[model samples]
Target: MFTARRLSMVAAITAFALMAGCASQNPYDPNTQAPAEGGVSKTAKYGALGALAGAVAGAAIDHNNRGKGALIGAAAVGAAAAGYGYYADKQEAELRRQMEGTGVQVERQGDDIKLIMPGNITFATDSANIAPSFYTPLNNLANSFKQFNQNSIEIIGYTDSTGSRQHNMDLSQRRAQSVATYLTSQGVDGGRVSTRGMGPDQPVASNGTADGRAQNRRVEVNLRALPGAQGATSTVQ
Candidate 1:
């Protein structure tokens, strides 16, 4: 007769095997720059881990009815894990759809989403004003931000190492502020938005060449879910 402890151990091992064996089926690879086309979602991975832990706990606690306890435990914990990532996952997917072909890149890093906007499309040379052509895209972004109100937005501006450090710093600050202001004007909650200036630091590419300098001069918008807003949803469409 298999003991309750042994049964639980077997369950854990099986789940682990499934998780590992299905690696190729996992959609979100933190190492890659692009989203996978077809695979198990990251939320499922978390649920699997949760189920494993829950099964062990449930079996250990309910000696009289270990199997039933394990089932209930796995269901509860797995559901919680799946729900935890739902908000961000949905938001990321929507943002990707929203930003398609707009020259902005939507990247998922853990639970956070980042939007990278190149300098040429965002701003004019040495100017804090936003380019006229970018307004529509900014409007679209503001709409999405308004829909995903649970997130705190941070806009960071970067400049090429072409000018004095202090000057670049100020320019970056102004550029970031400009974006923030525009978003707020579009009815995005100003309270959730903040801006910073990196001042020619954290270059995405070498500044020695014109192409690299162009790439380096840009802005990044990072969205992180507020602690209290986990699993929260908005009615905005």
Candidate 2:
């Protein structure tokens, strides 16, 4: 949950940032670079890269069994969040169809799937509570995940470059935990789910524009393969 004092401060910072109209860049992405190519949002690219980086970091910490998603650490960086190429193509197709026009993007990265939920649809400014708009799409995804129990999910939360680093990071962390809690309540196994807060480190859009900031503040769920997914969907369309 977001505290009132923190929210007030973040809201103040956000209001000022919006009025100024320039996005600040943390240590990861500099303000100078343009939007990423292939029309892929920097959020997804950076997230995937972050997930990969996380994997490497985890592997460093636990060299014996790096395949575990929990070992990715709290940061959840890197593209190799987990080994890919296990989910079925038809399942991905179904997920794509379900997410169509829902403002929830379904992106297939090799054997993994990334469902990107932008802030406008997930949460209001400076808050971590799940918004009503988030339910419909998540319910739809939850249904799919219930059937695909063999898959492990990594939920990463991000924010725009409006507030202080610590505040933004804390907000992002709470948001991720909220989403994870809701999903578990919806029947997605809590054990297979991991949450990480990337803060304003991975912006999909420029923090400069209101629309860009809206897109940058998001939660991305990456579905990865599990080794013993006996009845799991593994076909690629």
Candidate 3:
């Protein structure tokens, strides 16, 4: 009788362990391979945590009321963050495709892509206006960028040391604005574009030789998806 009772208890314990294992299944385990859609897995995790925290906080604040409102708010915040992350991923992919095959060098810096352009394709010497021949290329770029729904573009103009500091600064600002205008005209949303002139502040090459100066007098186009822009706390290094 004693042996039979011990066996029954052991069997019950084993069943309970199996049930617990089944109940605790983690859907978002990283070891489980993700789907081919390239979704933002991290965002989903963050969103779940955010929602849980929100619900708890909400419930704590309103002890008289049930935790329903808190749970809803938390879920909303999580969903919003996840949605933004997905949008950012899509924009990044589209930008990569559009800039590919073009002569421009595209570098992925965090959540933004930087297009480094030499002076030859962007502007003429001591000129703030873009050359007429560059219109087609610029237009193509703008059109390609239109695929991104929530991204911002920044045009940064630079110059060599051939002129006064103030003069260089002014020229650089105008040049940056010119590029921004061209982009806006080519279907890119005007509100999503910004311009800055670095003058001789950030040079890619030495300013001692003609070639280096030419390289220095260039424009850089920086494109960042909205989520990245929002999360970015510091200037580009």
Clashes of each: 0, 19, 0
List candidate 1 segments past 4 Å from native.
1-40, 60-64, 229-237
Total backbone clashes of candidate 2, pairs 3 or more residues apart or in separate chains: 19
RMSD of every prediction:
4.4, 20.1, 11.3
Tens digits of per-residue lDDT, candidate 2, 113-211, equal 688999999999999989999988889988888876667899999999998999999999999999999889999888999999999996888999999
lDDT of 3 by residue, 1-237 (tens): 224543344334334333332332222223322422244343444445555555555545655653454545565554554444444444545545555554455564434557877887778999977887567668767876675546678899999988899999999999999988888877888888889999998788899988899889888888776644442222211
TM-score of 1: 0.79
Q: Pick the candidate with the highest lDDT.
A: 1
**Residue 236 shift from truth in candidate 1, angstroms:** 9.9
Cα lDDT listed for each candidate: 0.76, 0.66, 0.63
Candidate 3, residue 116: the lDDT equals: 79
Model 1: per-residue Cα lDDT over 62-82, one tens digit each: 778877777677766655554
After superposition, which runs of candidate 3 have C-alpha atoms over 4 Å from their true positions? 1-79, 224-237
How far is 221's C-alpha from truth in model 2 (Å)?
A: 0.4
Using TM-score as the measure, the top candidate is 1
**TM-score of every model?**
0.79, 0.61, 0.60
